[model samples]
Target: MADSVGFIYTFFLTAAVIYVSAIVIIFGVKEQPIRSKEAKRVSYSRKDVLIHIFKQPLLVVTMLLTFITQVGNFSIQPLLALYIHDLHGPVNLAFYAGLAFSATGLGNLLFTRKWGDLGDRIGHDKVLLALLILSSILFIPQAMADSYVMLVIFRFLYGMALGGIIPCTTAYIRIKAPASMQGEVLGYNVSFRFLGNVVGPVIGGIVASHYGIPAVFYVTAGIFLFGALFLWAVRSHAKTNERSV
Candidate 1:
């Protein structure tokens, strides 16, 4: 699309798609609040919402992971086309670049629900940990890809791993946070992710300019690795505390 009509038009087309999706959500997705038999009301203040999230180890850690995940994920965006051209040379670049980018979304589409099911059966923390580590490992291979095909393949796998993170994080919050506060807490989680989205490209641009495009992948991998380790330590400490109690 960008090749045929320019990126400005391509962006407009993308915006149209987003509008359609939003319309569908607005029209088709209805939420009727479940009423308890007693119908009692609990007033959860905004300040309490902030304090509650901080007190919950899982919520705080998952929010951090969400931020880290977005940072690592978007860090590749500014550099991907350049990397593709450097590795594959500059012929028919648009088609190859589109496929390389789309492959990750395709993987996410096919495997996210499966990962969610697996998380339901096992545990979201364990699932999130596995995905973080897998995502970390996947980024390194992209740095070392020998061909366009290899980069696309690794990205698809990385996308599949990435798919699990959101569901697992959302499920963790949903299961643990009170129903009255779930929406606000999730909103906070999203704010962290959006902040990461803003910061990610800047970091990628700076690192690629200074250290070259491949170095961005290494930095992305480190971010995911740090997230995995952080989640693991929190999960372990929580379990040990449970035992002591």
Candidate 2:
């Protein structure tokens, strides 16, 4: 599309779309008032916000999970083209890599809402567990992929799993935190995600350089498992604390 339309033109077109979106948001969307902890003060100091974030075990763990999840995602994506080559994919495997990337996005588009709905029906925690575990398992097959098509399929499935995570965490925060704290807590969550984005590719590149590209997938899967285990333990501990009290 960029080639057909000209890259420079596409860039401007995309900027225009974003500007229009921003205009719509500013003009069209009505934001509710913030009350209580947030509105009473100018802003929570960095230290105070950090303290509050750490005090909530569930939120802390969820933020950590978000970070780890992105680590896995970023780790694999930056080297997807190389993985396709190793799989003896099609001659246009470079293009196939892009396709593989888009596959995950398509899956996200198709299934994100379904995952959110499922989370609503069951529980966000369980939904989180399912997504993480399924994501972990999906990585193994991706590592073992014999063709680009197979890898693309796995990426799509993994994306489906990924889509629900943000929604679940957002919903969880809304239910668990005061409105004032919710915004800041979610801010920290996004910060964690950005941190993971920074770290994941470096880790992935290092693992690939030392162990081979397939090893990166195995390691990515392990990262996802670590998130699942961490969240599970936190949930268990919280439950135990509730029972004892």
Candidate 3:
């Protein structure tokens, strides 16, 4: 009942925000005039978009990293209740698990915009590297935790570290993609994110049921580390390409 109420309230709130944003975009702000027919044309067909994306090596790396990170992040969320129950034998495991999942949203709400601003001030690669490393380190405590309190602490830390990843990834994409193809590129990125959402829980459930709850954290850490290494390699490749150019 409480969960249902919360979901309804959240839905209304999100709808209201979207409604306001649309209103603002439509009336509260000035709009730019449409481009004339004589303006340069950019191909946005599916095949052309895919070809454009494949041409940019950095975008491919960013998509892969985002996919892996998102999978690792979301995979553990659904299993947290079971893990918490096993760890602390709580009377209200569902409530505590909801709290655990809420921690990630809280972290994102508090830090996502701030991280984006920071990425703009610093560089996306630096911010991405820091967040990835910190998130990976936070997983250690989560994997080793034996109590609900400890699990909550580790989860919160993990959430805070992860708060920066999406913003940085988006910022990197913006810098890498041409203005004309931004939407197409972002569409591809969103597809990868959705793929992660689909795969994460299935993998998490399998690992948690067969092996153990801690396996979730260990697997998350491993995936995150793989993303970090891949990002580092991509950064190196970018520098090499720049030098060659």
Candidate 4:
């Protein structure tokens, strides 16, 4: 009976979200000019754009880091409900699970724009590196958590770290992409992100089932660390290139 109620509640909530999102997108599209110079100027040869992207090592690194971080971040979502149920029994797990998952989305809603503005004001790479390190550190508590409450706390902290990542990544790409090829670059970036989202949950579930819930956190941490290291390497290379120039 409780599970049935929870399912209905979740279904309605999901439908509400979809409805709101559709409305926002509809209104947003109506507000935009149907055609503009900026849109018209968004033309570039494929070979030339590819060559330009290859030349910009930092941008490539940023894209790779973004993909890795997103995969790690999203991988745990599908298994979170199961994890909560296993830790605390299934009685009210759905409510708690929704709260845990929604916490991250709420955090993102509140912080993403702020982080994007901050990234624009400061440096995207610097903000991204900090977020990666913070995310990695926060995953420690999550991996070791013995109770649902502890997991929730860790997940909230994780969400806070996650809140800043996407905006900063998008800002980094915008700053690094050639003005002429921005559209193509952004399109590719979006595709990669979607690819990460599709794969993360499956991988997370498999690893958690095989190894343990804690392994999920450890794996996420490792992926974030790798992204951070890669970004740091790119930063170093950028400095060297600037010095040479």
Candidate 5:
């Protein structure tokens, strides 16, 4: 037992040393030159920059959509295992739970690039609308899943739908934002995404505890549906050329 424990400790220590050594070596190398153009003198103050970002309806809408999607995406992760168990899944409950959890990632990985290319061909808004609606619809089966296999299959399909979201969002921002402000827009999008990640798990735990596991999926689906409706409204509003409605 002592030898086994020592081996495990030694393995971790070796990994740590290798990671640190790589970092040190990389840092020791000369840094690459910044290829992007340097900013010229500007009259804009900090407040002006803040106002500019806030004034752009497109940027605000993109960030909101990204946040909503992230919240919906992770909302079930904390409760997935418990939900499967509650459904009276197979005897190998742990294995199925792990499979269900991993299926989403596998599906996402397979579909991400294809969705990105599709968004590039079509408009981002159109792609976003489709993905949002499809993802919400896929969640219905998850909420009503009678077996572990069903849950995994639904989650996998949901993930494929989700895979398009970030790329399309980023592509939309790049297309809309000024070159100088694009980085700032992306940074804000990331901040909102992480905020969603932090908030999602807490909300999921509360909803599951109070309303049971299935309720979590129902609520998450509703949120995604709401996001789709909101996106539709924004797109419609953007298309109105007249000053008056």
Candidate 6:
């Protein structure tokens, strides 16, 4: 029976991979004619573009905020299953764990594009600030949640708030960064994100061991609030400079 189960699992996994690969091969290949248009838009050399991006206050601060927010967002990831257990979850702990984990993605998927559009219409920085504050508020309930259902609900809302932040940051970058270096700056943002992923769990584990799981949520909420304030300062400084000029 065990051998049969293993064989079936492997067979389905292999079939899924092949199916996805085929779809990608069929539909994913495209030649971008926009490359020429992009090149024509920016006359600066790559080195100059790099230096300009590095010197931009908005880009630097946005990247830092990205790092901080990602760290806070993912800090509780490794503890979610254990948290469910603490809540005295239903018999299928694994199922609840999966549900709690996926709830964030579902919320993110639903809200990301809407937030992106809103950012485009209004202002990315403003939208990002609002989302950060909202996310921080949502984390409070998550930290205090006593039931599995409540935890899932909070996670879902947290995810929705988080889903808006990254795209807003990206939109801000595009508006402020030199067109030639936008891709590189975005890549750096992604690196910061991964750096946060690396550090979040380690720091979370230490905090959880010392204080408790709930404390992790509290800490993350504080971090998000701090990041929002930092972004606000940066935005304010920019406006002040613009007015003075």
Highest lDDT: which candidate? Answer: 1
Whole-model lDDT, model 6: 0.85
Whole-model lDDT for model 2 versus the true structure? 0.85
* Candidate 4 CA-lDDT value: 0.81
- Which candidate number would show the highest TM-score if scored against the true structure? 1
TM-score for each model: 0.93, 0.86, 0.83, 0.87, 0.81, 0.87
Error of 5 at 37 (Å): 4.8
Q: Which stretches of candidate 4 lie above 4 Å from their native place?
A: 1-20, 34-42, 178-180
Task: Write candidate 5's Cα lDDT for 148-234 as tens digits.
Answer: 678888989988998889989999988876655666768888999999998888888899889987898999999899999999987
Tens digit per residue, CA lDDT, model 1, 1-245: 87889889999999999999999999999998757432236758899998998887878999999999999989988779889998788987887788888999998999999999999999999999999999999999999898888999999999999999999999999887888778898999999999889889999999999998889999999999999999999988988998999
Task: Encode model 2's per-residue lDDT on 41-81: one tens digit a residue.
Answer: 65566777778778879878888888998898999788888
Output the lDDT of residue 139, model 1: 95
- lDDT per residue (tens digit) for residues 20-108 in model 3: 99988898888675374422365567887788777877778889888898798878878878787888776765577778887777877
| Residue 140's lDDT in candidate 6 | 94
Off by over 4 Å in 1: 36-40
Global lDDT of model 5: 0.82
State residue 220's C-alpha deviation in candidate 4, in Å: 0.7
* Candidate 3 global lDDT: 0.82
Q: What is the lDDT of residue 211 in candidate 5?
A: 93
User: How well is each residue in 180-211 modelled by candidate 4, as lDDT tens digits?
Assistant: 67778888888778888887888898898899
Instruction: Give the per-residue Cα lDDT of candidate 2 at 185.
Output: 77
Q: In angstroms, how far off is 181's CA in candidate 3?
A: 1.8
Clashing pairs in 1: none
Per-residue lDDT, model 2, residue 44, is 62
